[model samples]
Target: MMISLEYIYRYPIKGFPGERLEDARLNLAEGIVGDRKIGVGSGAMAVNQSGEWTPCQAFQRMTIRPDLTTFQVDRHDHILTLTAPSGRSETIDADTKQVEAGNPTVGDQLPVYRANGNKGYWDHPDAALSIINLSTVDAISQVIGQTIDPLRFRANIYIRAKPWSEFQWLGSQLSLGEAELDVIRPIDRCKTTSVNVKTGVADLNMPALLVRHFGHLYCGVYASVKKSGTIVPGASVKITGKSEDRIIEAAANAITAPALPDWPRPMRVSRTVEEATDIRSIWLEDPLAKTGSLSNFKAGQYIRIHNLAQTHTWRSYTVSAVDGSRLRITVKRDAGVGSQAMHSFNVGDNLTVSGPFGEATLSGKSKAHHFLTAGIGITPTVAKLRYLYAQGFVGKVRVTHVARTASELALWDDVVDAAKRLSGSSLELHLTKNVGDTVGAKLGRPDPSKLAEYAKSDKADVHICGPTTFVNSVMAALGSIDFDEEKIFLDTFSSPSVETEMRPIPASEPIRVTLQKSDITENWTPADGTLLDFAEARGVVISSNCRAGLCKSCSCKILSGSATRLVGEEGNDRRQTLVCSSIPSESIILEV
Candidate 1:
């Protein structure tokens, strides 16, 4: 199979129409020439002030303002003409230093800036070229029952290849024409890809559809130029080298682990640091840096420590961060048996552990995101915030952390630093006793009215993590404002009331379940919350990382009767169910 480039494109101005080229010149250390050299920003968004690379939120983009796609731009010599869908037109002299443009929906007369660097205003900081396979676009079109235009992807180069073939090129060196390039990673699909370039309407949910049809939310690959050369549309693309672990390289962009089995292994504490007064951070890794190092968990997930010497019981703790192959868990010492055991562990101590469980995570969608936390609850949110910042998230973000005093604030530096990295992002630290930082600090508890005012108007997605009292109060506040209930995600660290589970429901009957591979059969009752729980009680191990059903690790095919999934479950096809969040409705046979 011969892979050839099908098209070449450049977006001279960000959030504007793309300019097709007959040929393009690729340079070493830089991507396509004259691509994304300028960007337009509205009054609500700030233009890059540092004369350097800034995140995409600083400029107008289709993710936020889809109406910008209604315009078609053509530059002839020194004259640039922009024509709207309604036959309205505007012209700008390229010689002029100041460029002004107006949109009917967003506002009028937005400012355009010409960035002064080779990096331009590209979303990724690496100044790389984005490539998409036309076959993958065709597959998405077939699934959605619409002919998708390849331009909707906004890639620098379009190629003719097999569907999903680009994913194999991760970490591989590719040869295109006379240029050599290194494929960085897979590009995660977002709301921008759902917009129709011609109609300016987001009629399709690209992220959800991709995750449903394919296992992951990815369609394209980003490559950094290595060797300089001129390339035409029909140039051949060849894979020059392979990646060590393509799965890990490809999944680095999304919150997913590799397709591997789960086991209890001993992880050694490589290092420990005092994060705050009573808070300590420990980095865990494989003792020999061998097989277990590949367990790349996601942010907001927790690891289960098993068989502690003192407690002799299994416990779950939030994995605060992931540094390469190491897992960092921040612990605040308390009177709990697990906390005391963990706090006593020193460097070189071994602990048996499994997991990276939980469903509460950051959804890679286009919307304002608010993280409301209290005291040590900030652990998971801070981890999520750091991951978002690294992925070049370009959306409105607000983080509110409440603590007794500044000395007790955990991961304060990480939160402040991530806020600075993300444009249009704000951090609000509330201290009941002392106000160490006056810049963004407030005294007293978080007021529900203020929380509503910040999140209600934008309909932002809110993540609340704290004690039972704090979580309930925040839930009530959002409910009082009539916020969308479905948009709120809660940390599932606490158990629900026993009375509620005991209440009778329509399909609360016992059902027979057969696990084919495990060769186990059991009768499940309402007491078993989910199929995963029932299987665990029966001594069956199903490969799982995030037990929240968001990560499709526990997805199994049904061979017989029907199964019902929970209301908010996200993954699985017609024949499959994520056992973590699904239950048997009647007698069922599972492939397992």
Candidate 2:
């Protein structure tokens, strides 16, 4: 198979048209000379002039400002010219140092400043080059029934390679012209790609379509320049070497990889911090971080940990924070089996864990967000708030947390820092136990009728995390205020009052259950409580977080027969069943 560079693009100004290049020079630790060196402030982002890297949300981009794609850009000797759809034109005089466009559609004349010096401003701080496979874009075009403009992806390097082959190139070394690159990881696509380059209209949901059709959220690859040199179009591309683990992962991606969450892996507890009298925060570090397994996790997701004494017993806890390959979970000491096991752990101990699972994660698409949490339920909210702070979000963020006391507050300082970092963001604490004891906290529980005051707008994404009663009350109150039910997200991983136990099968022909991936077949009996219990008894590790069936981590596809959900909300796809709560009616084959 022949692979060659097809095109090179340089975005002189972010959110503006890309300038096609005939030839460009590459340097180590820096991308194309002028690429993304300057970006204009918009929304909550202030003008940055210190040549420092800023998050993409800090500047106008096609993701939120699709109208910017309607303009054409050309740079000749520092003078940047842009032409609007109406043929009206504007120019930025780069020689004066700071350049600002006068077009209304382009960031509304937002102040522009050059930053990041030679490194330039990139979506990923360390990733300098974005490489795209033209064939992969064409494949998506075919699936969407429309021609796709690769420029919409805003990638710097475009290559002509086998369709979807670039995904397999991750963790591999690439050679293009005189430059060498370390293909780091697959680029998870976003709504930015949905914009029509010519019309500048977002006519499609690109990320949703990718998940629906391809079963993954990746398209291009982000590479770091290992050995840089000048390169032009038509330069030959070659794979120099492949990492063994990545090769195995590539093979899995060709089959059932995308559907499978990370199975239980033993991570060493590097540190344990006492956040409160009964609450402890444990930080676990993945030994093999090079595989990048822990890096894909999102905020507001939780991990399932196996009970130390009872390996079969698993419990779910929301991840409080993630730093590189290290993830932290804050747990409160309680009579619960999982909580007791977590409290017994110490530094240097290894814990069996799986899944950063849960549907309650942020899209980072919306600007306004409101969080209402109570007691220890602030774990997930803190994680999400930190994400917004890192993105430099300036929009209104309303946080209302109810706690017994300030000392019992998990991540209180972290939440306060987020509130301080985001301008116009508010943080209010409600102390139901002793309100006057805490400095700025209200004395009593919040009135459900007055909950509408917590949100600035009805369109704000409302997140509720707390005890069942608190959650239900807040949810009902938010509903009363006419908040969009669909826009509200909840962390409902609480255990049911009555835990379902494995029951004996009826005195009839035994049910035959097959685990496809495990290649195991077993007969069901009364002793096997549920499909999950049966799989575990057979030495088949079925990835599961909440054994009560809330997180849906142990969900499996039914190839034939039925193992229906016992209770809970129906999943988007009916073909899958939550094995923890599901019982085999007759016989079933599960794609485990």
Q: lDDT for model 1, on a 0 to 1 scale?
A: 0.71
- Candidate 2 residues 310-420, lDDT tens each? 323456789988888788999999997678889999898876565576664566677688888888899998789888877777677888889887678778888888678
Please report, in order, the local distance difference test score of every candidate based on alpha carbons: 0.71, 0.72
Whole-model lDDT, model 2: 0.72
Question: Which segments of candidate 2 are over 4 A away from where they belong?
Answer: 1-254, 258-261, 435-437, 456-458, 494-592
Q: Residue 312 deviation, candidate 1, in Å?
A: 44
Give TM per candidate. Answer: 0.46, 0.46
Colliding pairs, model 2: 51-115, 51-116, 502-529, 504-526, 505-526
Q: Could you tell me the C-alpha RMSD of candidate 2 in Å?
A: 22.6
**RMSD of each predicted structure:** 22.4, 22.6
